[model samples]
Target: MSHRPKTAALIAYAEALLSPEGQRRVEAHLAGCEACRAELAAIEAYDALVEDVRSVEIPTIDFASMELPLAREAEAVSRQMIAQRQRRSARPWIAAGLVAAAAAAALWWSTRETEPQAPPRAEAPVEREAPAPVIAPEPARLTPVVTLAAGEVRRETADGEIPLELGAVLDEGARVGTGAASELHVRLADGTGFRLAASSALALARAREDEIRLELAQGSVGHAVAPLSNGAAFVVLAAGYSVEVTGTRFVVSALDGTVGVDLSEGAVRIRPPRGEPIELEAPARWRSSGGAEGGAPRPVSVRGLEAPRVAPTPVRLADARMIRWSVDGIEIETSGDVQLGLAPGEHPVRAWDARGRLHTALLPVGGAPVELSAGALQADAPRVRAGHLDEADLRPVLSRGMRQVQRCYELALRQGTGAVTGRARLRIEIGLTGGVQRAQVLGIPESSLTECITSYASRWTFPPPGGPLTVEQPLTLAPTQ
Candidate 1:
């Protein structure tokens, strides 16, 4: 069966049979094939369907009009013939002749009424397409009805959720609610599987080919969103709120009317419980909640934002002049030799010396104090990859440190070896996840040794911090031994 026979084809056959050529083919085939005979009979059952679609503007059909009366009529005629025969033998012959003529007339009248009629005018178009028309089929109708429990809407595309039998096909970047169910086998668009916790629900509103669907289904299941080679977006639904983010991060208490988003370092959008959606810079935080229908989000400040800092390069011995700091336009400044103690925050620092010379620098604020003095003021603590930085521009901070040991260790080992050393400038790139992007040894000596020192940072990772971009911890490095 290379091709299945279409009902349309059968309909066409019955139509063609009305033609001389169709009549010949049917007569030839029906003479021998019982299957063909059966099919013909079946097709005849709904003969009205083959006619013009327009004329079928059906009024209720009187089914009683179609009843068979052949048996009853035959029995009545037989009784009449028996009475005629008993009345007279001589007249019996005449009666028999009359009966034969009458029977012939009756048969002719019945067959005449059943003869096919000329098709109606309105049906010409349907007759034309009766040959064939293409129409794509819909999904096989699954039982035609779906029912879900309270807080239990299920959907293939995480957002358009509806309470279902927990068989929704969740795609990558989808979400479900908390407390929706404890067991669910959701297939993400990225082909990943997840089991929702009971009393939790979420949505995978975002889809990614290279990442885990950012599903926020109830009760934070923990996020392991697939990493985008370059970068991508993710979103999940919780309560009346929805979260959009790029790269991997974490969220806690996203059910019960409150949702927390700690973008452990990535771009994200937090739609609040009652207003507009806000774009979140990397290394930022957000919270959300539910309201009325798909409630709008209200912007709320991210908690634990490190205060902004001001640190300008001083000529080492030169008296530091005017120093000022501002993030959202809140400014802080100090003059000559005295440095302003700015709060910890990621901010651009500007300064001027007594010579009226002005300078600017980007300051990544952790919980530590940054001196406003000139050249690189080494931190008192062992900073992430902060071994021997020579470059004035490059900075890389480690948050999740255990992931890159070899890279961090080599920089430490090469510190004093002077084994072809310089300021040992190095770059440690980190995602919001604090994972290393590219580690390079810059402004330093070049060698397999130099490469070795630069390469030593191949093992650093950052733990969840206050922001998205990795806390760039500028460091110095050189080849050892």
Candidate 2:
């Protein structure tokens, strides 16, 4: 028996109104049966014709005679069937009844044509009420973009450290950092600008369309907030203090155990862990030395900082045994107090206490010596040092490196000789400065491309380590068309 689909099945398939299993059956039947295929095509054409007719506007329809043709056609077909039955059975009454019905239909049509026709009347204008006004919805907010990044800057993600570059997009919960001699600048989608000072870290706690919150982990950040909409909030948080502002230009710094809020322009409210919130206007400065101990904030001068001149100076310290000092990146030994001739300028000074806590300060020198006391130092968060790269640390680096290599391989696929598909091993040596000191490819064929890959890997930098270290990574590249 032929397994062709019926007309109804073909129409259902054409309209896509069949269930998945039914459609599959119809499709299978149609594939082998040319007759079913022809039927489906005809059904589709009929559907299209019906849709076209529905779209056309027929200005006038004569409902008075619309059903007359249908009735006449039905009667004619009935009469023909009755006449055929009468011929077989010799029924005279059926023939007479069919002839009478035919004569009545003909007389009705004749009278309908002879009757006088009336003139078509014009339709009255339609009274359409105005449509309701449509209100457009607000546009969606976009993620913030990095407008500028200078000096040494990097972003620490769950995966690994990614060097910050201009035009980088920062999402919420991103942690950004700048090195000792580096600085970073960023702008939000709303045109608010942030300047991050050296050796500083800032985490984007939240960045929404209506509100923005940033947490300063260490160092200072200067913000030039733009005008915001009503109910909008911009907040900066530190370990012991929070600064809330609607729109303002200010600086927030977390140094040692002290938190400082300096307002360059506009106004902001500084709320400490304890004590009344301190409100400051433009050109005002407030400093709190003791965190959580309820340190009173006092107004200070709004003086601009100048670059210090270089000169040999004497260094004074309190409790030298409890601190290890470094001047201009050089470790210095001080027994109580020492006199050393140094360049006159802003010097980067770092001290590590006996408890392994690191403190950073800037020493300005010209003619007189610099004095550093324990109370004036800014202590940073504690650091965890490991002898070698742990699995946790190594995983992100591998993942990030693999992504970089994949990008490079994709470029190679567009620009190079053949598809590179193999596994390559790299042994990299990292310096204490968090830079790749050396990179060597092992177990891979020596070629210019391999050297280029090594060169690319050598540019990868991580956070500075407590000591120099070496790590080996294996990379697998798949063939790209």
Candidate 3:
């Protein structure tokens, strides 16, 4: 206690690998020691550098082309020696005397090889054309431009680090990093682009025509890749694995020794360093347990609602511990304030408090931006102005009805649309004494699933609201993982 913590202990503490008691001890010391805290920061920085080095792309080499010029030079020298031998062979006696003299000359030359020799006489030197210069293959036409830079984003180049601005073209090997709460978006000349999340580091490792590789050392990225030409590939290297895709919309993350991939559309092949490659299709999720070979992807039961094809309205929300919203049945989750694209309708909004309790609100989206406050959601209050249902009372009732929701989705999946996956919104009106007053389905196309859900929901009961209370519920349908 009187001395300082060792380097190994500090490392374990930084990685959160120490026991709870050890963590408490280290933290207590850190609270009083600035030098130890600085050491811990340096340790984390070095670890990040090592992760970046691991994601570097190894360039391919063509050995045949490199050796061609040397091979030709050796061949030319051999031909010149043959011609000299032929000239000497025409005079046999002279050639025999010269060969005997050459032996003694060779013996003398061996002993003097280490000594500095005099320059060749002007006429004694043989002239030869310099070997043709080796021409390198042309580099790929990869031009990436910064499309968006939000908050504190910087790019590292040979000329040193610079603040990344809109329209700046990124050079290959350049690394981009985002500070906390910052994000960055970059688009390639080929219509491929990616959005980097906060507190992330990514390197544009390679940009050859045959292959384009992005190295992700930390955080997450959402990518939209255009279809590549024949024999071309797009790859994302993260942690110890690589994701290769021709064209796709997906999300990849390399954070805290964990790597994950969520494929919304298109197909991809993931390769681990020591295992066989994994193939993934659309609407699937893959995660690894701190190693490329540790885990596999599974199909997700839920997916976010797709933004409307046409111009959709944007809804903004206030900061919260966690905010979840659903429009037309698709739900999305994020922390802090964010803008969401929603179709013209009334969407359900949910936010969590510090103690993890849910608060609910109804946000109407039309044209102008609508601002929602998590602290203002009153739908969950136990006695809300004498007409509302409290979140504490609503959550348990919905939880008990999840079986009906699953049943409806499973029945619909069996009805020849097995591959179909989407979200559906259900609207229910509860009357006094917890009676179901009305039930309706919104957002999803009308089908047997909708009919089944509506029929089951109308008969459900909940704790009594003083008066009429209407709420929207979200349901997601997908194949079993």
Candidate 2: lDDT over CA atoms? 0.64
- Model 2 alpha-carbon drift over 4 Å, by segment: 1-142, 290-481
lDDT of each: 0.42, 0.64, 0.68
Cα lDDT for residue 170, candidate 1: 34
| Tens digit of per-residue lDDT, candidate 1, span 146-168 | 11112233444425655444222
The candidate that wins on TM-score is 3
**Candidate 1 lDDT trough over 10 residues, lowest sum:** 139-148
Off by over 4 Å in 1: 1-198, 203-218, 228-232, 273-285, 289-481
* lDDT, model 3, position 135: 32
lDDT by residue for model 3 over 1-481, one digit each (tens)?
4556478989999899999999999999899888788889899999999999999987788764655476466646643443333322322332334345655345334433232222222331120111222334344446566654545678987788788765466766889988776667676535577777788899998765677899999998778777877768889999989999988888889878888898887899999878889998987777877334333332221211221233345555665555444434533344545444455678876665555556777888766667776555754654344468889999988887878888888887878643457776789999888889898888777777788888999989998897878989987767787
Ranking, lDDT, top scorer first: 3, 2, 1
Cα-based lDDT at residue 66, candidate 3? 50
Which scores greater on lDDT, model 2 or model 3?
Answer: 3
